[model samples]
Target: MEKPFSDYWKEYLNIQNAPCGQVGDTNEDTLNLLKNSDVVCSVRFEYRNCRTRIPVLMKMEDGYKAIYPHLSAYPKESEAQLMKINIQIAQSAGVHITSNEIIYLNKEYIRKDYLDLNEFLLRSDHLFNRRNKPSKTIDECMEQYDFDLDEWIDTVQTLLDSPEFTLDRSKKCTTGRRCSYYDDCFDESKLPDDSILFLTTSSHKLQAYANGIRRISDLEPEDIEGFKLQYAQYMASKHGIFYDKVALKIWTSMIQYPISYLDFEWDTFAIPPYENMKAFDVLCFQYSLHIEDVNHNLSHHDFFDTADCREKFILSLLETIPKKGSILVYNMEGAEKLRLKQLGEQFPKYKEQLDQICDRMIDLSKPFECGLFYDNRMRGHYSLKKVLPVFTDEYSYHQLSIQNGLNAVFTYRTFDSALPEQKQVIRQELSNYCKMDTFAEYVIFHGLEKYLKEDDVNA
Candidate 1:
């Protein structure tokens, strides 16, 4: 007969309390016991009057103290209202809940030998405890994030009762995440070619719309409020695409051969996988380098590892990249440069070489970033992927399996557990995606050069 979950947990806790006989044996035993235990892992809260249901409620208890888990690291913008609704439901059920707690995975513990539930639990401290502030309890959080319960109920009832509703286009939408229905709400395709939306630096979008300023051409110098770059972008869009030949020429002149166009793909794990690695430390798994020689010859070098390959990646880079020349990386300030700096700190033995690499590195995004280049087709985006399509149809990322950095990270992460055939496929997809980034840089460089020369000839 199988043991009841409560009994199993109680027995397991007893074993944990007992003196450790062996180092590895206790943890392994605990893990095996946990796997065998069967319990109600999920809870569904159904309201009688309300149509909505709370799908998952994580309940944590130690002795007589019980609390609901606050899962997120930071309180979300909508958390106050959501908490009020939850508290209202609890109150109606004759359950008095005073405060909420948080339970998160311990980032310090690596599952090297076996899973340690106690270690995990200890690490998953409540928000206040984690922040080292015992005085800031859940009650304080409730007070700080208080919402009007009656007003919330009224709003919910209004929403439920509404049969037909018009979209609130004028409502100031703000979020860190992209809205799915953005295209459905505001059709960018239907917008005029010279729409005020093209003004990338304009914070007065709503004001412009209100004042009947729709097109970039319609914008007066006075309307822009002394923003030279915004004015330049506006004038450029109105005439055609903007091209600063002298600025671009000077920018391109800095490119010394053998030019190494580099791109890296890395993943940030919540838990540290290796020694000296902190929680959410990035593991660089892959890199792609496209080298162009002084003789106009092109060669490619790349590295991909299924495991923690930080050391191997750096070594490969040092070997593959020539001792001399400029290293061009798109958005160097944001991605590549930061990654290199982190790597240098992680591997101090290679600090000198890494510092040299950083010294030679140049941002390929400068021209577009400085507003020296602009195309109407770019749609206010300066991303390499967006800029690439405007120049030539020769290169594209649409055909690749791993088209974006996020997809590459996800794919690489799954490689260790994947089947042999699947692993091979992931490897190829990652290589292709990273290679495209550097290759795109190469293409854009030449495209800009050709444009400059052609403009000079026409002049």
Candidate 2:
């Protein structure tokens, strides 16, 4: 059986004073054993330009020799200068040096295997040694001080004291990517006990709530009017907090709709995965649609889990969805329309059909994105995952094994690897998560509709 990397590293360290190139090896016996091996060969040389030492690997070929430079080889000129410097070092050490500065004089030696390791370790002794070595970078320092269970528990307890430690309130975190604890340090339960985020009125906007305003009804009507009615910065002096019930009436009227609630999951690419493809194509992988009927009842349609199957998926979606509905989506430009255009290019045969979907796409998110509907829970960010929790007692994906699209993609990709029984559970979980997304959209639409109808009655 092969040893794990840790075991191999420990064993390597036990060897004493092995050779010029073998790191962690301290024994001369181990060095001789390595030298006698037919499959491996190594040598050490000093470079003068930077006063660096490097190891080269040598391997045996049919009747000739080949040299593998260390991974740490510097600029071409630096290597040349170092080779010259190595010869001078060897001469000073009372070793006979050839014109080509061949020490140990292995005429037929070749280099192979562990070339990168040889270069990394042999060229710079600073990493494993302290002499002439600079301290590691912050990232490297983090690796060095790997925390244990006790240390982790202490840190978690410390974060629990701060309200800003919660996932939604992360903007208040002082360290921007600079802290070593960025990934491992966070406490989800540290959100304020009485959050003002649920309030619908504009006085409890994200900023107002942050400034210690916790309820919609508490603010004077002027505060709501300045922000909601005139879309003015109500917090500013003179312009002040003004709430106009008349303007609020008109603002709420735009909420009427043959509302189509939409959601999509997509695959983003670093490199184009296909010909004529650009980086960052939102390859639409799944979508959910929930529409309110003329009778005011809601109906839903959804697509999920495919690969190289996007073309047929788009065609089916175009046929199934209505052309002239108020297509409401949490983040329309980002999720629905962006993917539609990308798929359109791939299936030019249905370009007109796809464009039609884009034209009727009315974003439910516009009110939020334009700051018309601000929630303190969102902490200045408008994500449906955050917004969905404001109205209903339900969370969009609380029960699912995978919480968001990233986790969804990762789960979908590995679904086939599991045994049949395990796969069944995962498949059910994925379906449940996606279904909840559309259902949450339905809830938001209903809430908005109710708000509008009440405003119409008051008007």
What TM-score do all the candidates reach, one by one?
0.78, 0.52
**lDDT (Cα, tens digit) per residue for candidate 1, span 1-459:** 023332323233343232221223332342343234322122222244442222122223421112233322333334334555666664554433344444444455444443454553331222444344434444544567756656766887888899966665543543455477867777778776557776776777667877888877677767775554566578776887887778888889998999999999888755455655654568888899999999989999999985668999999999999889999999997788888887887789998898899889999888887778887777777898988997889779998887888888878778888999988888888999999999999999988998988887998
lDDT of each: 0.67, 0.51
Per-residue lDDT of model 2, residues 1-459, tens digit only: 023322222233332233334544333433354356422224332322122232322223431121223212121222334443443443343323332211111112222332122211222211211332333322233234433434544676678666774444333433334345544564424544223343333333567666777544445555655433123222211232222334444554554456667777776643234443443455666777777776788777777655556776786687667766567666778677888887777678887888887887767665555555443444434577876776577565776777887898777767667888988887777777777787887776566556556666997
Give the Å error, residue 62, model 1.
Answer: 13
Off by over 4 Å in 2: 1-258, 375-379, 394-396, 455-459
Which candidate's lDDT is highest? 1
**Global fold similarity of model 1 (TM-score):** 0.78
